[model samples]
Target: MQEFAKKPTAHRHPLPHGTLTLTTNASSMVMCAVLEQDTDDCCQLLAFFGKKLTSVEQKYSAFDRELLEVHRTIHHFHHMLEGRQFVMQRDHQPLVRSFAKTADAWSAQQQHHLSAIAEHSCTIKHLKVEPLPTSEEYRYLFTIINRSTRWPKAQPIWQQKAESCMKALIGWVSRHGVPYIITSSSWGVNFMSTLWNSLADNLGAKIIHTTAYSPEANGIIKRLHRSLKASLTARFQGGIWRKELPLVLLGLKTSPHTALNISPAEALYGQSLTLPADTFQHTMSPASPSDNRKAFERIMPAKATYHIARKVYIPNELQNAEYAFIWVDAHRIPPHSPDYLGS
Candidate 1:
């Protein structure tokens, strides 16, 4: 838990004789930045900052998070490097060349970070990273996909790295057919041109960005998350949450939903999941209890109505006959009336 003594301030200070560098790295949960003065042999730290990301920030793509890391570093050390030229180092290649190349598809937050960096003319460098792990190590592990649901593991990856997300998504698509649409927040990864273009061309599916701060727009997924959390908490404690996550997910998928009137498995596969309880007795699936009165309303005939016509007479002669008819209204001109006009 080593701490740096020099804190960033608005006051000016004498420029360093040598080059000053800002190196930053960002992950799903945290961002770390280190400001140092480069010497002949080694680098001396001027300031160091590490901050935890919020829930919304955690969903940002790798490129956007890296850009955010650079922006925060520059703002924190504004006084020290006001007029002096410095260098920016990041591990994400897209971010390293973001200013050099046009980023028309960059998110709002990424554009803001790029604008902040443009205020200070600095050179960008990319950090060389080791090759990430492939799906080979995970292959021997989850065999339940073949035996049970025919779906990928429903739990988050252990030691998840940057490339793991894309790999997992590919695996899912291979097992299940292409989905029609994907809805997610405006995270940097969701906007990746390479990832989306392939999806559009191959699957004819597009990603839809959810409105900010509105969880209700994705209520079903949120409800599923809560259900999984409650199920996991009931069965496991503390460190065992990760271990039993798959079991809970299976139960959730097999259980029936009240609104859909069927389990997720049945909805997807068009058949009910078979548990270990009973066998080939040919049990009949119960019909959904629908009210006959409501169902019959669509086909029922409209209520029958009878129409009656009233007769009226006038004191006039018919055109073809030599007969005249006299009109009398006994109901209106009552017999007791003193003066009643008759035609």
Candidate 2:
């Protein structure tokens, strides 16, 4: 009798619900923005666009190329916004202004695209750009995680010149909604710190910081990086990595998420997504039974059961582990068999 009850519960675990996290890296920022919304929820991506030139001479030579890339990113964002709503978060503020400047600078065809985005009648909010800490040890990737979806996305913009990266971030947030919280590693430049102060004075959004070195507090973003790298490695062969970024990104967006037990597309759109024919082909017959359709529709698994199982399994799995910790809100816990404050 007990086994039968457990069986039913176990089979229904892993449904996609609750908070969503959006994680992004620089190479795949466009794809990240495309996946930032669901039926009733909002998904956001914070991105850093890299600048190619290292010196003033190179900047002049690469001017056209840099402008084109920036235009492309803006165009992509416009394309993703079709009939959807989203919030953008960023570590810098200038990118937002650049898009507006670029829009003003466009030729006819490009102007048309920019005009349409302007006509979309969307709202763009700019978070005040923050300065990084003076300490060199604390800089790492920046991330934006949605409070509701528990989806986190990150971009490593450290090597890129800070100003351009900040601009991209600002542009992204201006288009998307304001974020509830921004998480980052301690040290490096405290980019969000300045922004938070301004936001508190202006927008009234609270800026909270997590404990130092306790990235698990920012687990959603960390997990996204791990998953993205793993997915990229699995799908691409040696040369494919550099050549087929678009396809790899499409796969990431469409792939099933373990936490949500559904593809990111489904979580945001409230419907099954159609994959490109080149990437996926339908195997079912045209006259396949309705039962099969129902099976496909059931993307979300039972949440309560999954949470119970996760709680029971995670602690034992972490036993005797060194340097492991758990983060809840502002607090961090060292590895141990201990109950969470609220849970």
User: Over the stretch 69-112, how does candidate 2's per-residue lDDT look in tens digits?
Assistant: 43444555554444444443332344345455733565665555
Clashes of each: 1, 40
Off by more than 4 A, model 1: 1-153, 159-162, 188-202, 279-343
Write down the lDDT of every candidate, Cα atoms only. Answer: 0.61, 0.46
**Cα misplacement distance, residue 245 of candidate 2 (Å):** 4.1
Query: Which one is best on lDDT?
Result: 1
**Candidate whose TM-score is highest:** 2
- Candidate 2 worst ten-residue window by lDDT: 22-31
Q: What is candidate 1's lDDT per residue for 108-215, written digit by digit as tens? A: 777787887898968888878542233423311211131122222453554433244555556667877566665544444534446555654576777676555455
Q: List the residue pairs that clash in candidate 1.
A: 61-188
